[model samples]
Target: MGGQVPSKLTEKFDPHRLVMRGTQAYQPRCIALEGSVGVTTRCSIHPQRPSICREVLPSWESGEPYPQCDKARIAHGLSPLAPEDWIRFKDANASAA
Candidate 1:
């Protein structure tokens, strides 16, 4: 679930719904989210998270910008992610492996 690239066949963990849970009324968050929403966060079920979760971010891996990703980060008082962030993450993950 935590991999940068999930396989086509197993990319989605949707049973037709999202596990939305909001700590604040202003925004809806995922129940599987861990750590802080804006400052630092990771999915508790990264491997099994829904496809929407994986693709909703500014998908530099796919060469697409999803406004929703930056919007959510801004709402949470976090800076938007750049492609370099993704690159760093990918590199770190590769090193970890």
Candidate 2:
């Protein structure tokens, strides 16, 4: 199990547990990328993704965007969504509703 893991990540990782839990873990080894993420954020296996993936909401409490979304955007060199962004999102949804 440990044989496939990257040298850097192997130090703290328990490959046996990873294999046992599979996709149930927060950050599964199966979906982990060896290198940096590309420009696109699309999931290749979205169609067959686990229930956990389907359950994750883009935002929390309807109007407020999730902080993790901003963190990922920042990691990809994009600006974090501001408070005004949430206001606009809520306004757009309210009109649609």
Best by lDDT: 1
lDDT by residue (tens digit), candidate 2, 2-97? 234433322323644322223345644434333444443455445544444455555544667777776766766677667676778789999999
Tell me each candidate's TM-score.
0.55, 0.37
Q: Rate the local accuracy (lDDT) of all candidates.
A: 0.63, 0.52
Angstrom error of the Cα, residue 23, model 2: value is 13
Model 1 lDDT-worst window of ten:
4-13
lDDT of 1: 0.63
Clashing pairs in 2: none
